[model samples]
Target: MHSTNAPASRILVTGVGANPGFGLTRSLTRLGHTVIAADARPHAPGFLLPTVIPQVIPLAADPQYSDVLEKVCRDLAVDAVVAGIEHDLVPLVDMRPRLKATGVRVWLPDAESVHACIDKAAFHAVLTANGIPCPRTWLPEQIDEIPDGVELVVKPARGHGAQGVHFVNRREHARVLCELVPAALVQERLYGHEFTADCLVDRDGVASVILRRRDLVKAGLAAVSTTFDDPVVRDLVVRTLNAVRARGVCCVQGFVSDDGAVAITELNMRIAGGFPLTEAAGADLVGQMVNGLFGLPVDHGRLTYETGKVLTNYVETLAVGDAEAPQRNGHSRPVASPAVQVRPDARRNASPFLYGAETAAVGRVLRSGQYGHTDVTEEFEQRVARFLGVPDAVAVASGTAALHTALLAAGIGPGDEVIVPSLTFCATIQAILATGATPRFVDIDPATLCVTDTLIMDAVTDSTAAVVPVLFGGRAVDLSAVRDELQERGIAVVEDAAHAFGSRTPDGRRVGATGALTCFSFGPIKNLTCGQGGMVIPRSPQEADRVRRMRLLGVVQSQDERANTTTYRVDGFGLRYQLSGINAAIGLAQLDHFATTANERRRLWRAYRDALTGLDGITLVDVGEDATPHLCQVLVPDRDKVFAALRGQGIGVGVHYPPNHLQPAFATWHRGTLPATEQVGEQILSLPFHQHLTDNDIEHVVSVLAAALDASGGTS
Candidate 1:
């Protein structure tokens, strides 16, 4: 019988198909413990392990991942959970509380430590902050600072397994690779002997490190390695582990440079793939790890190993021929199933209409290290200008920023009055107020649900500095009439084209193409979104330049400083309202697929229009030929009852506005009774809309809405 104080327990090991997880599972079982192996891939080879119970789980990014993992642990009665992969670390760290409540132990570092190890940029910062020697690193935005012909390695800042890593000698190549690599980080390529340290940290923060020289590395895995005793390397590795506050079984990798200096590369929060070499060299690594995992003392004496113990790894097929498709468990259900699962109060208010390209663009910006305003933001601005056929465009942080900057640029300030639609978003009034100008609320035309030229002309006075005609529901207003009347009276027209990005006039001119100052919103529910961003299409380059300066705290040439590290002069008033490079990247990516997305959106809107043509108690908004609807809204009776019924059936609904003039914050600004605006506010209901909604989803939503209208005693 085996004599050991470490009790045999049921352990759940994730990423079992990977070498470290697979090897760890086998070793634990050999030490007389039950192994429950889990993997996101159904056909993971670890499932073939003898006497192991295997379960398939969702990828770490899945929304249902946490629930599925908890269910697995609860069902299997797992005593401890061990993550075998780096990607699983964040999710597991988030689930630590629930797992502990179920009496399952986990051996991992704190959230900050895990992130530091996983994110290369953060790791570089941590080590550098602690006076540790590490490779010189630069974010993509700082690529221009790299010396010419310097050897560089462009890799994902949050990468694993050497995937998407590129090596080059020119700074330009690094820049090009940044576009391709996800969350790319540029570093000085290290040359010399690479080493891996198999490490174990106890609860008291004491760490044991076993040094090994990597003789040959293939595809990020050590092909040939030998255990060695180097106090210098071991000491440095321990210092790095401490810098990251790492705990339990983890790995530290670095290189002994040609200059005889050790420069740490990265630290892994889990066991090294070649840890078996340590065990072969006489260290009971896994045994001691389990001892520390279950609240027992680690035998440091057992961690000692002899020098020159070699390990050679070679790939061999563990299985041949056709393999059976493994059954997916724990929230991996088929999407094609006819039955729809509805959850109570699960109606999403608004969701970003994302495509896979958004992630790719975000990765490029992250790798470039220019999270602030940079080339990507400029590129997006240029694209928007071209698409709208405008002379220039200025991208800002939000729609309100765009409006505020545009008004300020147009010389609107205190003692000035700006005409706004009362039935529109409160942001319109807020933007005017932000410019220190009074908002003159005017009633909307009942036919268009938009402020007409007559309303603007009536609200005008000697104090009227600008007229902001809001395009409701992606529909264009009487831009020509408003522009002609307002300009003759010396009143500037700043079209609040927040909902009319793609809408055009009857003359075929895009809504933003010909306006003096057109502000477009890219908020979450807007037709096009940059997560949360906005742009201003200026009539002249001078206006664009002024808006740009105003966005960067009114610093003249501030944008130039972002491109090249240099001092800038602040000459006027400005706000820190510049859009970030990452959000701009998302916007550029969204434009790349705008054609498809716009067409799809139009198709869905048309479908809704056709289905509800004669439906009683609800009337669809009359969208013109030049209009591309951002929202499918209806004027309905018993709006609250219909909203509740639709929400109860898992359909999301929204009330566009509550009459900005009547809002508590704007109640003081309330002037005359705008009967049209008040009546429309009570009747308008915005239906769920986005690029991702399928034809089936639209049909289902319409069906629920029709039933809701009938339940409220509406004529059908």
Candidate 2:
């Protein structure tokens, strides 16, 4: 039944592959609520439901089940959880404290109460203790004590769904069946009319039950059922619920003899499979349960239903397709290490990859107690210089600091202007501003989001003291055509190679080795992180010395040299931008495995390229073959709506930049309209690209992207 007055909620329904969970998910969605349908099977039928976020989880018995469920709830901000099967009841009861901290509400009785209901032997004991009529049961060891002519039902004690249940007339046959079944228990088989009660117990120990007779049964589920009221059965169900202290939604099953004798057999702490019939008979079962789930009062008056309504169920095909797992690429294996590391964060725009050695290296540095510019820092600088085939590399606090000190070293000041692309990160513009030089924001090529030679040459002026060509998306900018011209005009070229750490120029030289003053960021989420550091590739020995001194507060002497004397010399203008030895140690550990990181990134990008082929209304932003791609972006129509749709599905889509020229911080320096930059700003969307992604993850992302585009009317 649809309840218009009930508040819509974000509820997670588990065991969605089963009929109870599947029907519940559909009904909740029909009532205008958001549902996160979860199941242990990847191809569960409920996953195909409209407007539902589908998630695959571990089985209830797995140790990682609780942790994964908690992460899903916290990540999706789910309000409440409803289990549609009995397998999850015990685990959900145990995870109460943990799930409570994550702000997910689960309505269940205490652990003992749940065990008593799920365990048949325990259920018999509890009902018998309360003086309620129930079937006589015995453990596997006591099966021989049964009467000779009594028909027996042998089944697993802690099982559900009628699995592994058998009927036999003799004690020898029952004993043999008990040996075959796990945790076996035997009970006297009863011959009577069967019925199931759809029940809801409020917090005040009061229960309202609507009874339905199993007119036609198959595989332990009612194929056809009719709702009816009987004082004797309702009284027995209420007693059973109170004896177990049941709360929230639950169901009770038992036998009704022709002589009016009632005997309860099963009590499951979840919604019954045939609950829709109760709703069809005019009962607000799910709605009132939702009220009690969120701590509102359950209205028992709403639980009243007509007695003559009938419901017939048939097995219909919900979905038909493949069930096998998708194949994986060979290169998609995890990083091999001496110790384990956490998986990469695949939801962010970008994140760092760490090998196991980084922790040990950082520990060694901590033990040394020399966190200043020490031998470790110098070793990191030399290692980076050798990798880029450069004469020297200077380490600093961050990529922004590298740009600030490098521009200052290049003689750019308040009266000067630095030409930079408006399509780059804000930090690039702020770095130039930090050197007292105003930014001459220029347009990009729109294909690579990089400044071309023609664009840079067109923006040059007499006040152009330096040109900062941003290496956007790890694609190097080729300024070869205007390099000599800019030099003749005394304009220095400083490469903002923050995203181009391992990328190469067109001439087969590494980006940092192109003879331009290059800066590489090793920030937390960069391709290579020093935790929080950056590097500068200087053009000459003199430039290297100047940047080195500038990073150490303009001190002319090194740390070792200063220690030999009373004081250090403050020779020139500088800031405290020196990279700590601890950070350098992390960088050193990363350098040893740089080759694997680069290969993994390139492979993941190609996976995306192959998956997105032939899709309409999507133009992938190009990064040349030689470039070690830092980001995977696509230009699509209606990007904002597409981004929101994808994010609603938890795809982690983001916008790399929003045009620095249009930003208020750089509004004063806005020269004119940048048509290409402005248009590209609205169309570019960054997909999640990182080293930890496998081929299967890429497939899921692309599939979701297609759906999002179709929903936004972008794929026309």
TM per candidate: 0.54, 0.55
Model 1 lDDT tens row, 388-475: 8877789999998999999998889998988888988888898999889998889987667888777778888898999898888888
The residue pairs found clashing in candidate 1 are 139-368, 140-368, 140-369, 141-368, 184-367, 554-574
Go through the candidates in order and give each one's C-alpha lDDT.
0.82, 0.86
Any residue pairs clashing in model 2, and if so which? none
In candidate 2, stretches whose alpha carbon ends up further than 4 angstroms from where it belongs are 1-346
All candidates: CA RMSD in angstroms?
A: 22.7, 22.1
Error of 2 at 428 (Å): 1.0
Q: Whole-model lDDT, candidate 1?
A: 0.82
TM-score, predicted candidate 2 vs. hidden true structure: 0.55
